[model samples]
Target: MANITLFAQAIGRLPKECIRKIIREEKTDKHSKGYDTWSQFISMMFCQFSGCDSVRDISNGLNSANGNLNHLGICRAPSKSTVAYQNAKRDSGVFRRIFYALLAHFGQQAVWQRTRYRFKMPIKLLDSSTITLTMSLYEWAHYTTRKGGGEDAYIA
Candidate 1:
């Protein structure tokens, strides 16, 4: 159907680079360099929201686009274990920056037409509600080495 094709086209379109430019990454201190370079991080995340559940899935099956992403200068499509290792060791705040970029992109996509009908109250999630389980919470829960590990009350 035409509608299906339009939706598919939207999915196939690359996210605007403006979204990447908007997120403000914190300046790293001289002593510490971040792992999983920015481009690698972005590629992994792009694959993530596109519904790739695992790093192996990133370049495998329907959502696979490792080659495509590589062509754009993002880091190499990593092995599953590599993705897991980097994710566990990296600063989570860095990942949050990607999320912020996504929110900005979504905001830009919202159209406010003059002839639109009155907007109704939007829905919201409760503070304690379970959100998406996209995190590697095992690290947070075990706290094998990080301070305050095993804190069940922590937010994802």
Candidate 2:
């Protein structure tokens, strides 16, 4: 029997060929040397699995798991700034396409085979409501008893 890290086992379910195809199609790694698309994907996956709240936490977590970097297909842990930059600059469409691709792939499994419906298209519900903040707790909102003043105040 061979020993496999839980992370490896989990991500191994994804089809490598499909992922590579998406990578080539998106050209996300173009002109990048070290921290390419694969690195960014792996880093984000780590953050998601480890429940990291921020880039610094992801960097520190990866740093601590230095010995497992090879297993994750990354040469080294990315810096907090690098993670932040990639997150802010990278095109979100690449990830979105990858997600739908994987979803379609897995939906073919036996588990989902029986759940097919007569609908021709899938319906996805989205919640676009802004986060609610209490004026009493967030005094920076400049809430006052005066009407028509504090209603438009938002944190972001």
Candidate 3:
């Protein structure tokens, strides 16, 4: 049996061909030194999913994933310096273009599917409310244990 991590499965579902096409057009991997655009993307995705707060955290996390790196399409986990360098030097537009490409790819499926209900024009609903603040911020406002503050209101 082949051992695969859930992360690999998730990454596999992404439109890699679309991303590669964009990377080719954008020349995102021109200055890379072994660390390709695909690796950079996987690292960022791991950072987000793992809630890593620093480059060191991402490097350590990937390294700890052990043999699973190959399943994620990375030969090896990147070092802290390499990840940081690529992050700082790589064009963010490549990722942005990839996002739009994936969005368009998946969004078209939703657009073609018919819903049970239809509207003549598009509709938008907005829910806005005021948030209450502590009494220190609103001294002039009326304050009661039951109702809370009156004058201090934050619109959300």
Q: Over the stretch 100-144, how does candidate 1's per-residue lDDT look in tens digits?
A: 766666666675423557658765543453333323654444333
Arranged by lDDT, best first = 3, 2, 1
lDDT of 2 by residue, 9-53 (tens): 877787878887998999888877688887888888888888999
Residue-wise C-alpha lDDT for candidate 3, range 134-153, written one tens digit per residue: 66666654456544444333
Query: Model 2: residues >4 Å from true position, as ranges?
Result: 1-3, 110-156
What's the TM-score of every candidate structure? 0.42, 0.67, 0.67
Among these predictions, the greatest lDDT belongs to: 3
Candidate 1 vs 3: which has more TM-score: 3
Better of 1 and 3 by lDDT: 3
Candidate ordering by TM-score (highest first): 3, 2, 1
TM-score of 2: 0.67
Least accurate stretch of 10 residues (summed lDDT) in model 2?
A: 147-156
Which candidate tops TM-score? 3
lDDT of each: 0.50, 0.80, 0.84
RMSD of 3: 7.5
lDDT of 3: 0.84
For residue 12, give model 3's deviation from the true position in Å: 1.3
